[model samples]
Target: MSINVFLFSKSFAQQHTFEVKNGSFVYDGKPIQIHSGEMHYSRVPHEYWRQRLKMIKAMGMNTVTTYVFWNFQETAPGVWNFSGDRDIAKFIKTAQDVGLFVILRPGPYVCAEWEFGGYPWWLQKVPGMHVRTLNQPFLDSCKTYIQHLAAQIKNLQITHGGPIIMVQAENEFGSYVAQRKDIPLEQHKKYALAIKNELVHNGFDVPFFTADATYLFKGGSVEGALPCGNGEDNVDTLKKRVNEFHNGEGPYMVSEFYPGWLDHWGEKFVKVGAKGVVNQTEKYLKNGVSFSYYMIFGGTNFGFTSGANDGDSPIQPDLTSYDYDAPISEAGWATPKFDSLRSLMKKYVTYQIPDVPDAVLVIAINEIKLNKTVDLFNGIVKNIQPVVSDTPKTFEDLNQGFGYVLYRKKFDNAINGTLDLKGLRDYALVYVNGKKVGELNRQVKKFTINIDIPANATLDILVENMGRINYGPNIEKNLKGIISPVMINGKIITGNWNMYKLPFDQVPDLSKQKSSYVAGNPVIYQGAFKLKKVGDTFLDMSNWGKGIVFINGHNLGRYWKVGPQQTLYLPGCWLKKGKNTIQIFEQQNDVKNETISSVTKPVLDKLNLPKE
Candidate 1:
């Protein structure tokens, strides 16, 4: 590899020629560093794209990097959505308009603490399917997705007079674990190379690279491509790791330098503080290295699309707010971290940054009265149709995803003993004859729950998918809603079971219902609030138990009493000016006379992190 390391002179004609040579990025025969920040367009509302970009630029970033969530784009099999938050082209162009370049990481598998590791839930429908390796089904799906995605962004490349200067072939491929134990690491390499081919075949002539943490470069790095590391170390450290593993003769890059870590439901909100972030920022910028801050602006996960983390322990669901404790808050407001970083970056990088934009609008809503309620059983729609099976099946077997499945059976004789759910996927709300009994939670790694079944009584188990394992070897086991049958007293209860698929896209009309039946059972609470002026807010879940919040038919996200996140962010963009409806489906808790409220501040219940 040859290098042309020349200093970029502003007085001279601004050369836009970008290439990798001699361990440095050369622009118009001059060395250039990419001070980039990662922020997903899918997470933020389309209305705030430009404002966030401006915020990123004012923080001394020269470029914006983002992951294209395949699941969010291709919601259903064969059906694609590129409009709204899933619109990638508009986002890239908006970044460009804000005077920043773009780095696109269009992963068929992006393990950014996202649901199903970015794989569409529909992939679970394919029989004998495998993922994240050289599997035919996954490869075919990836190819079709890439082809469709490339068509939308091919002309938008910087080479084609667009803002996207770099492209990542596959995200963290070297860190991949095969779907099957029999598969070899070499198969992973073939899978990555195939994706590289797909990218180049679709006319992406820009520099293509792969990103991995701690310099794991085996399956990810390919011939003629760059290997990048993701961490908080200085320039020399990131460069040394990538160079020793791949090539010392190429430009060094930190693809995902972490400023803050992701949070699980029961874990404390992850924060790196302003001092820690500024200390690292000063070192990397002054040392002539390129880096991208992972999630400089973490947005809301919104809906059941939020995933869980089961890396090597008990299952932990991710909170609704992707706030990340980043410099830019989830509400798009700047924190002290923003102030410190901006002051530090101006001290080093010799570039002009514009003034910081004003913070987003926020408002406090009045306490909402949940006047009406509908029992979950009363609200069951046509899709909850029952399927009688001798042996219980998983959600995929029933062609369902992202919801709860009810399994119930009736016994003639009285049995008083503990019930063993051999293969309960995650969490199951237990009920006896429509009465709440107990719960079996897989988060604590508990599979069995104590129960006393009476004579001629019905036993029902409602299993929910608390997001799919977003990272680690457990990903292949991402089946939800009871993958195996339940056993009690060492006997397989051989009886017909009714399965209700609760894929509640939207809440049904509460007025159509007679009245609230039971409290402990799953119920939907309905309320209305009149907004004189729309503004950002957080729907407080402190008053209720575990459930999701839907405002004006839009699924904001989930919340639980055992939460570090007790509120769901209600972005002003999602709110209308008039009366707005708020609905919540509490799985186990009863909300009778209690009412929910909306606050301006988010409650990252730090006190509850270590407990339940």
Candidate 2:
């Protein structure tokens, strides 16, 4: 096997040094300028890294900036994955290979519209864990991650012949204030210094900088480095801000010039006009200011990595499609944004931009009706034990993220009365004696129903974690499963509730069923669809309530009954020519009556199709 080291070396790092002289960026002790753009390698596949870098280079960009999501690296604490698309080192090397210098932002908390601000879920398990603060536990973990990451790329630094020139200390820290305008200067400085010190101690010699909104700087202080903002809409404003901040001593820089925006679950897709981006880029270049577009290419949120945001409105969780209306689409196809930027970039840079790569070929397969079915409740009861509770427990107390939990309790009192669920986060489907009783949805925050029950009968209440709060200021407060207390007839139920965590990662063992097929808890529904050929088709999830869907074992991600996403786009890569097995683990045991359908277009469309 051959190993290449020159791919990591940067031209500026080989012999050139960047300095600030007379308020101007001096490279190799001479006035220097830069044109940069931002993109994430994890968002794009490994095969497309070089092409995207070349695209940026073609856009006349001399520098390519990227954020190293800690969650993507150390998925679990102390566990690191650098292979495949998570290869940050390889990404940097590829950038250098394309004649582009690199800027690295390794954030333990990068709010790049990522889940948990790039912090891994396991971090929340730590005792008394507080993120992005002076918390010792948080700081200790941050230090460990920084040390490990620095070791990987520190040697590749410009001072060490590596492509990385500048390292950002943190990402937009002032956006969370009460007014969305004040920076926690003291806390920000302390944390930045802590990270800077840790990196320096770990042998990272590159200059450090911070990226925030322009007005945020007034609340904080940047002692010995560059401070760039995000609101560089036009060249004149960008120049004025840079001149005011740097006192005309250095080139103006927009750390995050928004090129496009992201979409929430219920919102329509967003697209930023190409003319505006081109005009802005031209203005910045002509004014001699360096800029980095927030996201040149947006990729898939694959798996459970998607996050939600909270503002003044309800929480908005991001959809699986991370097509942020970027230059590069979610499927890695370049749109008009890409070509417009490419043409604009060629005017200033000397590097040759490569042609866009071809899109993945799509193959279509015929749809077939699947009639094979497995009875879910055909089993003998071994131990039908039930506890007593006046009221049920909410999802919060269960400590689960998303999914269903069954609460069974024996009630001896004869009641032909109404049953009231105090805190059903969103929705619930009631069942009595293996029969459908009634349904409730929390959208209106009401889960009341009338049912006649025999005296001392076992009453079972199953609750679903109808999609956790995906966005808004309430995001951090999102807890899966049942959230609050359950009440019956204005009385709270208090008893020992059997809690089941239904996260996809904890696949329950199916071998314990006494019958050839066990139907209820942790049931895996399988159906085979015969297709003459396989091609790209959208799986219409409108029939299915809420559950993760898998095709032939490949996880397509979590699907919800809530719109405006009723269909999931299935790429042909995971499909087979003959028989394809569709498996669903429904949270509601009684939802066996619901049938999922596959359609060619988005299920939410007004086109009426034949229903099976």
Candidate 3:
């Protein structure tokens, strides 16, 4: 490879020009194929970023592709966080240091099975805001996100001696536009152009590409940008489709070659075997078709960052563990899939692949007894002030985005009738007079339960915003909590009600709260386990019910009795060599023994198979 030296800042830098010409990626005037793997910085801990990048390179990947989650960086309107795990610039820089080029996909709307499809939940509050379109309010916000994001990485572009080569426009937009019968093709193209223009306006000076299925190229691709196919491994089909839509053929790339699949709660874990991945990858390598494994190393969702999918099936919320069953496990350990792919890459790539890094140590600890408990109905959490209203309000109405919300109403007169929960976005645990009643789940399509209400009875309905719809048209209407009205029998229960916003932004200090376990109510259980040495481990949640877990104050994400994902990936880096604390906000399931064990391996495939 020829070196291009240029004077950068106060020092001479090795700046190389990257371009797509004559069907190939030409770096410094030499044609080369991109061997890329996708991994998101927002998904993995920042402490393990460098090691993960190194693993990607070791697997014979020369390029690292990532989606810059708009929601991850900007949690609220005008609020941006690029430091720590939200640091995309550092991630790209680290990839370059590990001898890998970068393909940046900064989606103001990236449906990576991420929360709200990588969109800030607050966007729903903007009047007349329609996402993935030319809606002015939405576009205005997109521009702001782009400007702030560009400020962090514009200097890191390949032209500026950085690793970023190609920047992706709106992700899989064709899928969204193709289904809309009311919208014209021309209007869709204009919408795409607007996003592409925003990228250019913010100084993202690089070759831009739009990724979609073959049929979506026309609707998803911008005029000046390259159109890349996703989830298509057949080289001939890929070429034909590109030529048919793009009017020019040659350099073909599969933006998302899935080695594994995403998992949703209450469903069987999706697994793409290593043999299948190897076969498809070998074909791509032999045909000189560039590709990026959708997830080379699927990490933990680590909080309420997981999204949901609602296609032909019922609304399926994604599990907290984004293990993806890929080459690397969620705990950052190598697997047979990784080994097989590494060997295959060594056979095809002319360049020398680096040696695989040493696997991170994983330790298993004995059962940790949860001795202290705090009731949610009590005063464990003192931050959330109740919003009093006549009717139940949604999470958005209360200025809250994620987490659970409690709706309480006291009836003065006794009534025997069916209690109907109207417009419950996701899941809810029903309680009357501080006693557990029946439950309502949006996933199971349960909306009403028969209840015998006594005089002076307090009805408490705690609803959880499982996750927003990350895909399809329904995302526009995703509002958590009771969106409409609660009814008894045939009449609306209209009166005074208190709605508490429990966003759980951080695990509250519950040490001062009473330490007694309350049955059938949402409670915070606390425990401690001492370790001589620290390493990666999985916390088994089979003994407990649905809730989020926090270790040493770091939110490890949600876990439910709903099988498929029974263990949560606990990183060793987050633990110390002494007493470590664990707190679980379990909402249901009366605990016989408040105990959980740290296991070495994850039990992700075990599904709660339905009975006839």
Across residues 1-612, which tens digit of lDDT does each residue of candidate 2 receive? 011223334343346565556766655565656667788887665766776676666555677898888878886657898888888899988887877778888866677777766776566667886666657898899888888787778876777766788888766654544332233557656766676677778887777776767666543325555777776576666556555666555556788887888766555556689999889888876777777887776666655666666643344566666667777655555678888888887675544555555565544334434333333333212322332234454444443434466666555665556677755655566655555577665543456888766776655566655444432234445554345665556655566554433445443233454423333432456567776676556676666555566677656665665555566667655677787777666544434533456655444322222243
The better candidate by lDDT, 1 or 2, is 1
Candidate rank order under lDDT: 3, 1, 2
Model 1 worst lDDT run, 10 consecutive residues: 1-10
Error of 2 at 340 (Å): 2.2
In model 1, residue pairs whose N, Cα or C atoms come closer than 3 Å (at least 3 residues apart or on different chains), thus clashing, are: 23-249, 23-250, 23-251, 24-251
CA lDDT scores, all candidates in order: 0.79, 0.63, 0.85
The sequence of per-residue lDDT tens digits that candidate 3 reaches over residues 149-266 is: 9999998888888889999988899998877757788888888899999999999998888899977887787887778899997788899987776667667889899999988888
**lDDT of predicted model 2:** 0.63
| Candidate 2 ranges beyond 4 A from true positions | 1-33, 44-60, 177-185, 234-236, 240-248, 368-478, 506-524, 527-545, 566-582, 586-612
Best by TM-score: 3
- lDDT winner: 3
- The residue ranges of model 3 lying beyond 4 angstroms of the native Cα positions read 1-12, 381-384, 609-612
Candidate 1 segments exceeding 4 Å error: 1-15, 177-182, 232-234, 378-383, 591-593, 609-612
Better of 1 and 3 by lDDT: 3
Q: Which ten residues in a row have the lowest lDDT in candidate 3?
A: 1-10
